[model samples]
Target: MKYNRLLCAGIAVSLLWVSPCPILSNEQNTSYASPAPAKGRAYYEERGDIVWEVPTHRKLIALTFDDGPDVSNTPAILDLLRKYDAKATFFVVGSRVEKLPHLVKREREEGHEIGNHTFLHSSFQHISRNKALSELDQGQASIVQATGAGTHLFRPPGGSYNDSLVKLAKEKGLKIILWSWHQDTLDWRKPGVHRIANKVLRNARNGDIVLMHDFVHHSTQTVEALKIILPELKKRGYSFVTVSELLSNREKPDGLIEVNK
Candidate 1:
């Protein structure tokens, strides 16, 4: 039951791009499922192609935290972020934001950027088109209601997306934000802090988007790693930026760019 709850919440995280119509009542169609491994699928068939994780010559990196406005760990994470004088992105769940409006406000007041991670965080592929758009709209509404700010960026839950999903989000004036590299702190599994920290420290590079969660036990581990990683990267001449900031700085001609997705 505990695992099921987590899976449901995680799957519901893909609220962006849901259609506006009432959700259909059907367990097999509406219910969330465990993420299936798509490794053997073709690149286009796999969701990874929609994500970005590439190296560059610049001295910059973006740290993105997902699944919050958390009751646990968010305050501490914000405190640590403040202490380090570092700015990071938080891709918050819309429902969570409604519950923790103050946290969302605090995040915005502190000048950190927020991205929509959907209301329920449901699986994008599982939900209908109307549900997907509805989720994103609800998420945006919640963020504005909480923080009096608007977000132009979004990160699909489970790092998943499709052509229709992208089109829907873009039509709503949102950019589908996916990471290039992942930290996979697997904090959900209660991994050790040291292991999580080491993986991010060892793997992150310029233009890479490192994924971490701010809502669970392993979050502290990622935070701990950040304390070391942030300074070390600084020493190595790396500058940290929000995902939008990083994306905005990428050189482009005619202001036209491809969706990294």
Candidate 2:
């Protein structure tokens, strides 16, 4: 499962149109505060009914797409998933779902799971408790309107969460779903397609919840990367499932809590 770093570097050099820096990265000379230490799966689980990756031995991976139901990308992504018989969970924006309800409907109709990504995709870390509740409620309402069903999963915008936000999510009967740390493709940054494909292929493992995006502000890197990722992973005997399906295989805890890498 090792990636060829030389090949990836060469591809990046050749793809001159691709940005040399990530879009989300701070500009040069900008002084930003250092980030906090990364939290493990246990940190989230202990805080609330949150899950990053399930502990399991089966070759099951949950592919989750956030910030979507995009007109240009989502349908194509769905087609590719269908081609490989892979099911994914899409955490769609409530506003987008209201406008493009058909796309959300297509996702559910194709056996993919849909989760709320909030009405305005607001970060709960900065908003008030009442605002957070409104985001959750409105987001759920949009999903139910589109698919005629409510979702039990929610992923805060940018993975921001705190004690109050988690409690609010719990009160709404939503489990906060995050991705396995290593499986984030960063496709939203519009990195070269090979890089995105390699990130997932190289780090993929059992019980992984892979984070990808179906909407990326006029970029199709995720869709293009999937063109390579899906078949290659299928060859490796990995079975793609919805987040709910993967969660069903979670191992029961027996006193000691083992940290997931």
Candidate 3:
């Protein structure tokens, strides 16, 4: 299938109407670093409670979609995953899960994993600790309510987190899940389909937890990008699996490569 170039061009222009959200800036591209003050992936990696990428020798990668269950984009993504016989993890916003429980249910039925993205997609850096806990609690609750299953994974909105937030996730038995730094597609910015696809194709590696979004406003760059990413990756002998599965196959420290960043 071909990317709709004209449609993407129009969406690129419409991107100007979108408000700024939590996105890592160019300056913050340090190997395992996050934006200022927030604990980088390495800090959590030392604690062994957060996962940016699994360390495994197998050609396995976990494709994760965040801020989703959107009517416009999610189903199309699910369709592509099904077409490629690939499994993915979706970090869903709680509010959207409540509104579109059916889509969440469909994700579960199709052998995909669901993780909590927070009740309102609020950044922990901006909210009080209590409010952040509530966001986590409610987000987890909504997923259980929608699918009768709870998630063990939690992704801080915009990849923003601190020491306390990481501790809190541990207290709740949720592992903080971040994306491989190189695998971020920036699809939320309405980058063209080729850019999005190339981001994944060029940087893809074993145990990569790819970051993509399904809740982009007035955009379908992600869905179109996957049209190229999935088949191409599969041809390269990469097997897509859920994050948990990737973790289960993690290599021992002796065999581990320092590529999770």
Runs of candidate 3 exceeding 4 Å displacement: 1-34, 38-40, 256-261
Ranking by lDDT: 3, 2, 1
Model 1 TM-score relative to the real fold = 0.74
Error of 3 at 103 (Å): 0.3
TM-score for all models, in order of appearance: 0.74, 0.81, 0.83
- On the 0 to 100 scale, the lDDT of residue 157 in model 1 is 89
Residue 27 of model 1, lDDT score: 36
Cα lDDT of model 3 by residue, 143-259, tens digit: 999999999999988887667677788889898889899999999999899999999999989989999998999999899999999999999999999988888888877985443
lDDT of 2 by residue, 134-161 (tens): 8889999999999999999999888866
The best candidate in terms of TM-score: 3
lDDT of 1 by residue, 138-203 (tens): 999999999998898888888776555666776888876666545565655557776777776777
Q: Give the candidate number with the greatest lDDT.
A: 3
lDDT scores of the candidates, listed in order: 0.73, 0.85, 0.87
Kindly report which residue stretches of model 2 are placed more than 4 angstroms away from their true locations once superposed.
1-41, 46-48, 253-261
Winner of 2 and 3 under lDDT: 3
If both were scored by lDDT, which would come out higher, candidate 1 or candidate 2? Answer: 2
RMSD of each: 13.1, 15.4, 16.0
